[model samples]
Target: MIHNLFIRTICTALLLASAGCRQLDEEGLQTEVTIRLVMPDSRPVTCLEIRDETSGFYNINTYERTAFPTPDTNTATVRLRRGVYTFTVEAEATYDDGTTCLLRCADYNQITQAITWVREQESIVLLLKSVN
Candidate 1:
């Protein structure tokens, strides 16, 4: 009877320990994202801006930038929690006449993606042909 009781106690302890370790792993899991911005064929962009679209109690107004030929492909990596997100991007295009114009992603020009963020590296591409 004592041996049976000891075996049961050990199994119970191992079950609880495994559950705790799983919780810790979940807390440490974060989505690793790579965003790529592609410029229009006719309009060559000089700079690009990217930001998360959200306005609430916890405002996500922070943004990042990339310049021409700096990263070449205009790519940036961000870490985010598991959730649905909408990312806004603005491309600054300079014409041969030296006039620079900003093309923003809004309404029909927006890029919305749902990310589970469970994978090690997630890739997203946004083409900047929203403007003619």
Candidate 2:
């Protein structure tokens, strides 16, 4: 009887210990991005799509436009494949002349931010801007 009771106790202990670990590995392992939108002629724009080159992951947002011609912050959660990434943004904006430049600051600044997600991390914000 004692031997049987000991085996049950050990099994219960193992079960309880397993519960302490995280069940969902992807729970907090999301990449968040924030784009500080700006216009070609210095204006605040909204409704844009952000795409990661290294990873074929993208997110769209309709973040509230900030005060008068300033970059407003937009937040998004992305599932990264675990490594450094170069984020690219495409702002659906048209100038007064009705010309869409796609809104990229510069080729050098193509990689707005680099993130390494070894574990679950909070939302990461990327400032959205365009070439001056």
Candidate 3:
């Protein structure tokens, strides 16, 4: 149970909107994730994306990674089968906050665990603030 707030910069989200649609019939499962991405901080997040960590694996986005509100309001959506997925949360909190915080870089973003569609979700709260 790694529930510590470990923030770090990794890489940009994997844009998986190349094809129009992807087939998941062989897997024998179907689900739709209603992801509500919100920065619990005092300000709104610039942008966000949910992409798989493992390269070459099935993409989180079936058609496009920039889906506005597929599952719910204003959050990007990714529809696929029910299984474990290694994904990260990529979003620019702010560009010019006019501060001197060393941990305000883009690489200092947070990520979620191995997301599963079958399990019941509580809530994903991201507290973006100065690491001072």
Clashes per model (N, Cα, C within 3 A) = 0, 7, 4
- Which residue runs does candidate 1 get wrong by more than 4 Å? 1-27, 42-44, 49-73, 95-97, 106-115, 130-132
Top-down lDDT ranking: 1, 2, 3
lDDT by candidate, in order shown: 0.52, 0.43, 0.36
Over the stretch 31-98, how does candidate 3's per-residue lDDT look in tens digits? 55555544445444333322223111133434213222322333544455555544434332332353
Superposed model 3: Cα runs more than 4 Å off: 1-28, 45-74, 95-113, 119-132
Give the total clashing residue pairs for model 1: 0
* Model 2 CA deviation exceeding 4 Å by range: 23-39, 50-84, 94-101, 104-132
How far is 27's C-alpha from truth in model 3 (Å)? 9.0
- Candidate 1 vs candidate 2: which has greater TM-score? 1
lDDT score, candidate 2: 0.43
TM-score of each: 0.48, 0.38, 0.38
User: Clashing pairs in model 1?
Assistant: none
Residue-level lDDT of model 2, residues 59-118, one tens digit each, is 213221111122234344444434454444544455545555555533222235444445
The residue-level lDDT of candidate 1 at 71 comes to 30
Compute the lDDT for candidate 3.
Answer: 0.36
